[model samples]
Target chain A: MSTSLDDRLLALIDGGDDAEAIQQLQTDPAARQRYLDLVALQIMLHEKLEGDAAVVTPEQEAERLKFRALVWAGALAAMIALAVTAWFALTASDVNHKPVSVSHSIAMISDLSPDARFADATAMMNLGSELMAGPIHLTAGRAQVVFHSGTVVDLTGPCEFEMTGVNQASLKLGRLEAYVPPDAHGFTVQTPAGVKVVDLGTAYVLHVRQDDVSDVRVTEGRVLIQTDQEQRELAADEAARWRISPSGLASLEVTRTTARQVLIDFRGEASQGVNASERYNVFDPVGAWRFTSAFEGTRLFSNLHDVDGKPTGISLTSRMATTMAAGIAGELFVNPVDGFEYNATTDGVFIKGDPDQHHVIFHFDGLEPGGKYAFTFAVGLEANNQVAPKIALGASTQTLAPHDKTRVIAFDDIIADAQGRIDCTVTPASPGVCFITALRISYQALQPTQERMNP
Target chain B: MAGPREPEQFVQHLTAHQTRLRAFIHALMADWHRAEDVLQETNAVLWRKADQFEPGTNFHAWAFAIAHNQVRLARLRSARDRHHFDETLADQLASEAIEQFADLDHRRQALAICFDKLPKKQRELLARRYTANEPVTTIAKSLRRPAGSIRQTLYRIRTALADCIGRSMSREAGQ
Candidate 1:
């Protein structure tokens, strides 16, 4: 309950009738003291509106946030937190979205997670380690990069990221979850695709793929996403993907969910290589395909239906690869025209390169609607990986290493369509000697109709 | 030597207490311009009563007491004036303000911190209202909002500021 005089006081201050308020102040000592306190506060506010607010951080905790909020020339108040060293190389930029040539260090790696493993290039960045305005490639684990502008970025590897400015960074590849406080409203993350995401005091996660495609999801507050072509605002729980194709830069808003975290791990290099392949069946799949050059028997094993032609839980309805019939080990192997037919004991399957665009589209049906799936596969080739095939699931794509054959990549968050279908695609195929093998699809049902499955 | 330094010391004391003296007068008698007149009159009395002031005494308390007497005499002289207040109320206001003389600095500093916590728009509006001295009606018209809304926003801002300052003071005390 308010002291009824507060209304009278507010009304009195606004040129309303002050007789009641003045009478109350005259009689009640408490009212008089409160009136004086309010009046004093008013006088001070009038004096402080244009001045600086010196936030005095007590001497108790050195790790706690402590900074002086200084009003800059305009509405933008530039705040620098001393949590990191403020050694600004301080060269001015051209004021364009082009990458700033940073001469001095403006940020430091504040902390590393328990399992964080920095790449050999980033080996020197421990706690309180300063970062030059350049690429920080982490082969494994997570790190927290604290900028002098009070923007903190929690980065997970295998990622290539760079600190571009005191309040700015560029996510070239990998995942970064940024926390931009109000004092650091203009904290920016520039993707390799020339898309700049400027924070309006927000916490957001950005993932940059190998194909210059950046996906940004705002978890709190708002952000301004700008490219040379267009600009848009992304609010909380909203997500958009930016891609720089041959045409130009393009952005697409996607259906955002809690799957963003899983996608970050999917973007990481947490691979289950050949050594871990024996344990790959830890999560049972509706169907597992192992493609090989050798044909054990003329048995046609289809994913369409079982004995009674009922719809299977998961079925590869259609697939396409540019026609190729190779005589491997004295047996004729032809690419699938509409369906993949293989023997029960076949080692692997051949995914052909499309003649026109080299894009292999696989429309897998009978999935649980809105269900998240983990599609893990390995590339088995007698020759070196010249194809370097990429697997595309919705807004994310991962490319295989040319020298690595043991590494199995898992796309952990491919959401199925409402019609229980996944329109997955494989792209930019090179004609060499390779086939996708040990391809498995498994997921705990994301809907009520399904049961949770564990690996 | 003490007699020679008396006028200089008195002038320094009067000069330093000018703003606080005016505010103290304003606290007693609501009209700020009238408080100004009373503050000038109080300054003259302090100058005339300079020889009576003991050196190293609480200058604000001594000066504020003189200012309170001047406010009482001014109110007695201006019986027909609109803002003339009750004498008992005036005495209480003067005593309380003098007692809080030490805390005024801390409250003012705390206000700086509290002001920054206000939303940017509210802070700008408050700054414009006080520093630029813009009226609420004009602000409402310019902002394309109702005068009542503007008044309500201003009230809310003031309330937040007052509460924030109180919290800051309490936290400081605890620390």
Candidate 2:
């Protein structure tokens, strides 16, 4: 019977088919369709199953070895570059540029949060302060620098950059977004890998990995990137990557990708109603809870349930729930609401009072040992002038300040115990109202890297 | 740096379809590392032959053809490896899979729902078998179960998931 034939086909697909199953599939259209569907299912199943389980053949092993060698070589070159730079800084006198006074400032610190911290106190530049060519290290929060020529550079810490000149800067670590206007044409950003990115007239994001591999994403206009041996011009929505080999050899690779592609985050908008259609498209979460008034009557929400209408085994405990208008003073929001109606009332749950009085707790059981998980949530202060709340997930606790907008917090790389249970708690710092709109707990998967050049 | 109309259109099409193109190559190669290599090589070729690709045509099909050629070339290079499938069977499967590309998204959604419906034990087992790529024998040894029993359990779970997915998809169509 075809039932037996179907089973046979399934087994064959699992084992990489023999001549018989392939013959059967070639002749019968029904069987062929069944095979296709099952194979698709198999592929989907294979995707869900991750980790190093498959037996690595000799070829794969060789590829892995080659990759490791390249990475090591890149590291060696970065160390060499760092050493050379340090040596030049100590020995070279007025060869590059005239030594400026301590009070001389080539750029002004345009904007920064109150919480922004700098590694070097002397390196901190205020608005309209003349900035000398020196290292600027942002220890925490974000900082914006406006070059004398009008190039606005936003640096997110922990980041390190040096003002080489009024028209030039060098990113040593972390990420920076540079908006180069027409006046700032030829403004250059030198990466640690010795690649110089000269803006023709554009906005671009430059990220320097800890390994010194630099990634540049052009959001608008165009930019020319030059290494000692190679130079390439990248246009809008294009990305160029430069890396140095262990042998001090430099290479570059270019691809067409948006800046958004480099950062992994949830894509769909969160609202007040039940988002039954909002399924996670990229990575699956272990437990997810949407605090919107979508399910108003239900006092208990399960963590294993999908906000998009799928059921799971685990559950989350909510103390109080309510619906409110979008604009609540002191509320902090991470996403923009340009298209959303301001007057509309969205559903949300509140965690009020102090930690000892009332706290929202999420219990996750059966976590994989040695597995890392990310606890993400959308939260905002409901009342004006309320103190920041304390968020506890696993063993770590974070104190968050009160703000008018909603902020999404993602605590990643939290390891689970052998028992697989992780207790997540969110406690308000004061006797004020705080709202949680969305929550998700998912396994942490490493971001995939692009292919690199051998040189 | 904007190029002629053909190159601009090619870049646009390629960028839009990059994810799907990688997925197709992944389906063909099974190994992500290998699929990445093939996709990169295919991208270079696609860019070089951008003039040959029509502006208004199906870029997905054009890209898939190039990826398919690359997959065949890779297979030939690694013919001595014992882990890969027979060329004839793999080709047949690849063709069928490509033909069903239009239905991929719908089937994927159904599969996601069906996956959530599985019992915790079954989910764990499936994860071990699929995610960890642990062989059935190795899993059985770890769990102190017979290899045959473990295999049978996997088969039953797969059958149940397939039936569940079919029902959900049909229900959606009816709605």
Candidate 3:
């Protein structure tokens, strides 16, 4: 039982050398038992350390202390407000005046989970309860609020939103979908980015990222976006993204096709295609490749569907652009679906391509020469130390940088060749493998006429 | 499969074992935030698959298995950025952690007793280190002590607590 070995083992564990540590443990039974015991103890200690280490800034600590003190003051203020309202009600009744109530029911909680975690347990949100203007934090689980003016909002957790008024709410953070009917036409949502999105009889999904950049996607009708510097309107299927920098709202981009849905379902079955009449065929692709099979010299992947029992006038020919060593053509494996813990169902193709001259040329047939197409693909990190790979779709090339979270990169309006040859070059950042999933190329359709109107 | 239990009964069972299930997930994942997310996801799955779970059986084991699968799925999904443990290491740790769950209640009680035995200053230091999640460097800077010394103190405290728990468990067995 050398303490030196134990220390080395613990250091190794922290440095993520599990294989070596396990190997050493297997050789010594006593040390293995000791390691297990220590691991259990470590887990308990980590459990106690529930708060994130990176979040404890000096300013945040000071704010927390101030918040604790303000809680008492807030309680006292609430009591005083209650007393004043009661006194006013009694005096007004004696004078034949209308009695005033302290709390106004601004919105009703339409839907919420019973096990949803709330920031304040005392201020639990019950279904159909009239919620007054205050802070509502859904730490976990989704909740919906229906305002008195017929506006309905669904909040996805861990969201924090403050109910400012009957028709207005400031979303401090998180994702929310608001459906404003004609009666509640002027429902407004304020974000931390200083931008206020007012509904003009629309259903819109607003997401406020951790960096204070808000993205609003209008699914139906229109929305009036008002920032401190400028005001704009977003119609149906349009998306507006604006970031709040130190200087104020900067980098604002409004486009009709900024956010596109995955046209081809590559989740389980490979070689799936979008039907011409499908709802998602707005940006229809001539063909799609679901690279299910191995690269055997050169292979052709057919489109999922066929018109009139014949080929769908679209196909993809995959061939090695540059020949490398035998095992360099990235491994094709099925990635399990996240969040669905049970049911070991494989969802999508996880391609781990090699670093250097491992290039694959996808020749998409049946496309007009010089046609504008949007090539979108999702790249994810497969190993801890792996750098995001650089990928080129046609002429548009981008280095997929390592992100804190997984994201999709879309190359828009790239002109294809007469024969529709799209060269996909995968240059890995590091020796480790990078994941490529949900590859799609769609023909960019013509934009509808602008429907901008002054409200 | 047996008929689905009453909704109230199912909820009660879930609530009763929620903490232990979360702890089990945390043990396997080694990331608390990720573990919480997995726990919430598991809860949703449990409710959806309630019919699959037979009543009067080992609900804890069933739930543990689901959580285990969830941890695996999450690891698989985020395999690139996950630095802590690979699938093989996670699976090994998970099996061992589940075995330790048999004496979890006993160990918890022992920990509580050992925690009470610490001095007020040491207890406060533990609270600051653990509950507040303040790094050793931060705590050391505030207390005007070396970071190494603070880490050493914490290591010694944890070792002592582990020893105390072991002694308490042995005493209970003797009784």
Candidate 4:
């Protein structure tokens, strides 16, 4: 299939061998054939490399322009795509001749799904894709909707939301800060008005409200809010709210609220101290005790086996449990000799046998291995540091608020022979509010035949 | 005084000869990306030494000389430690590479008929070499073969390809 001088020269050129040796080979047919042989091999090598070449996207193309040059700076001359180049140039030049079109204003939203229309009706973003919904950066308004996952979206004021891409989103929604991480399957949101803003992987919020314009602000992270027309990004310290009737977004000024105020606003004004309770089977002597709030407390419940002998940790049970407010940063401590920790601010406390601590040295006797144990917790301003839990168990409810004396609750079967451990750690929710206490807990080693039930 | 500033001038100069130079560098390095690196360095040198470029001279040849050095620098900088072709070798290669690409014109004429006759893999391999300008080692790595063996196979294939292209071109020309 080999040919003559000019023909070999042509073949050599096609093989990316634009060298004088090739020209010289053209002078000598034998050398030309060898040159042709060498280049044809190289061409084959190049082809075998691209297993499945993917078409580059615009952003990818721009990035590639930056990195690829440093890689193959002058390896191959690109045969310019004359048609595309000509068309672009022609369009660019002609744009100067026409009058500019009027700009449109609209809100934007986007999500991380291949078919997700958060970006635009036409634009579908895949997982990790980002899309901007509108041209005008939303400076203000209220947008309420439900998100794909369990996320709620409510932007009631001014914000500039920029859509960087499908997965990358930015929100300048002021005052309100809510971020949903891409865990599990997706994320969803429900605004106060029941508007749904659901995202398979992200969450959104509003700094400004639709009617009652509270100066909501975003201090960190971004929230993707749906505007009347598109998706927008609301960034840190930026506030956005919605205006009624015409239903548009407008920028709003902010007054930074205190940490407590921020929490109260999110939770609601009717919030009382937090409280919770649970039930336990004092095994071998199978019986149930009515556990009550021993003191004003922040947290309640126990990591114990359930009715079916399965383990369940911490549950909000009674009105006492519900009314107690354990400001996320309430202080708590445990008493090792007795059993239970008390929250100073709410004066609430709960007791669990040492088995929960996995301590082999200290545990209530007759507590069966793998048996369910229930505990309660409460925290509120009105809680008296009384031994309510002790009283409920037919023991003295003394040592309430204003009295730091320990209440004696004696129970026989005090055998501490267990192998498992429960390390109770308490941490303050805010900087200057609370401190935590620790305890070493253990459980009786289950016999080989004992089967722990699953709840 | 008469020409543009360094970065600007270099950009303009590159834009002018980018295609040809890219093809030449592709042939020399057997990699489009590496060729691109050499092009950038060539532009950088051109920009830095704008004073050395005499006016009304063959800028192409002058730029080519800088490109030649850049190609060598590129080879040295490359992870492959590929053949660091000297200026003379680069010049020889650049010119020859252009000649080889000229065959593409003929191939285009017979492409429709010849494309169908060639094996799909071979045609694709030809496209990767002539169109994408990917590296031999890159291709070999994907193919899971020793680079030396890949090179030998490519050399053989090139011979066959040249024969195929020639026959197709002649047939097309006759028509």
Between candidates 1 and 2, name the one with more favorable DockQ.
Answer: 2
lDDT of 3 by residue, A9-46 (tens): 55543334556665665566565455555555555555
**CA displacement after TM-score superposition, residue A81 of candidate 3 (Å):** 24
Q: Model 2, A1-455: lDDT tens per residue?
A: 25567677677665554567657766776776676666667766764454234665565456445534533433443444344345435533332243434455566665665456889786545533446678889887677776666688988778899888867889889888889878668889887656888899998888888885778988779888877776778777577877777765376778762111111112212222322223321212111123223233332434354433344344443333222211111112222221121111122344445456656555566555666777766554322224444678867777655552325566877887887667766666665555554455655544333544333
DockQ of every model listed?
0.07, 0.09, 0.10, 0.03
Tell me the whole-model lDDT of each prediction, alpha carbons only.
0.56, 0.59, 0.59, 0.35
How many pairs of residues collide in model 1? 8
The alpha-carbon RMSD over the true interface for every model, in angstroms, is 31.3, 19.1, 10.8, 21.9
Evaluated against the true structure, the overall lDDT of model 4 is 0.35
Model 2: lDDT equals 0.59
Give the better candidate number (1 or 3) by lDDT: 3
Best by TM-score: 3
Instruction: State residue A137's C-alpha deviation in candidate 2, in Å.
Output: 32
Docking class of 1: incorrect
List candidate 3 stretches off by more than 4 Å.
A1-21, A24-38, A41-147, A150-178, A181-261, A264-371, A376-390, A399-408, A415-441, A447-455, B1-89, B110-175
Predicted structure 2: clash tally:
22
Per-prediction tally of clashes:
8, 22, 4, 162
